[model samples]
Target: MGLLTERGELEAERLTPAGERILRAASTLFYERGIRTVGVDAIADAAEVTKKTLYDRFGSKDRLIAAYLEQRNRVWHAFLDDQLAALAPQTPADVILALFAALTDWMAESRRGCGFINASVELAAPDHPAMPVIVAQKQWMRSEFMAQAALGGFADVQELADRLLLLHEGALVCFRVAAMEYAPEVAHRAAADLLAGWPRD
Candidate 1:
């Protein structure tokens, strides 16, 4: 967890409807326009709250972005967990393929790219408060991939993880730039071929 700027009084549960409104507006605006591009005043306008109230609730723009990333992280992790969970009781190879299917479904939705990857580029500051949260998300994702490989009985779990990480990140890059969702299919096929040749323990 990144250290927030100030020990702000941002208790999410205690947030008023007005505060929720601010969060909702921030989520939309920040996702559409990168975090740095959307100013505090713009968020205030979108949320229909005065800048004073926004500051009173969240303290700083950086804190607000951190809150947004945290919120987004929760939602995305739930989706990934649910999809990965469905692959249980199958061979790890099958589970890996199922994971790619879930990724394909995720890419079919419009305007959804890997949020952490996008945020990293936009923030550009190494010590930016958002970096820790993004780093955690990536670390967790890779660990989950590795664990799945291990469960599948693969002896070389680390190598499989490395290859899948490349495939997964490359797929996201393709989706972001070319608006191509086919990377999932291509990557899935390549992964399937790799697994086919690997000796099962």
Candidate 2:
């Protein structure tokens, strides 16, 4: 299935023209400014719609934040898909490493770092409407790592996935929070070394 259809929730095609505009505006604002800082009024103004239209489209600010995250997830997955196609990794291990390699370009395109991580930090409420979307995004990465490790016949796939996820998220945090310019490159090399030394079944 296509990326839009994969998640089966809030696909782009399902959105109305106003909803589309609202989402487009919200996504950009949320990423650039932050979820907590941006308001529905600002999003409506950016989208050239009224506050009533924004509320009618998204119901509330919380749902709008969730929609923004969902849209981001789609964009991220599409980016990785394009990278994997271009790199054409020969093995599952190579595929895993290719994801790390893609991070450099991904980070370069947007120095703001992972949107999900930023949202998680800003949305402190565990019961927040967007919390599940944020958590699922990170979990999907870990799941992908584990699936690739298993495909490569790696020993202790769970443990390997956990380690890879830590390295991946750590690099994202360091890049933005600590201002490590070469963080993604460093992560790529570290992943390569980790894969090289990882035991195979």
Please state every model's RMSD to the true fold in angstroms.
5.9, 2.4
Clashing pairs in 1: none
The CA lDDT at 126 in model 2 is: 100
Model 2: per-residue Cα lDDT over 1-201, one tens digit each: 221113433455478899999999999999999987898889999999999999988889999998889888888888988988888888889888989999999999887988999999999999999998888888888888898899899999999999999999999999999999799999889999999999999
Q: Give the top-scoring candidate (TM-score).
A: 2
- Candidate 1 lDDT over residue span 41-160, tens digit each: 899999999999999988888877877887777776556667766655356577677767777877776365777788888988988887887787666656666877887788788887
All candidates' TM-scores? 0.84, 0.94
lDDT of 2: 0.88
Candidate 2, residue 134: how far the Cα is off, in Å: 0.9
Instruction: Give the Cα lDDT of each candidate.
Output: 0.75, 0.88
Q: What is the lDDT of residue 45 in candidate 2?
A: 95
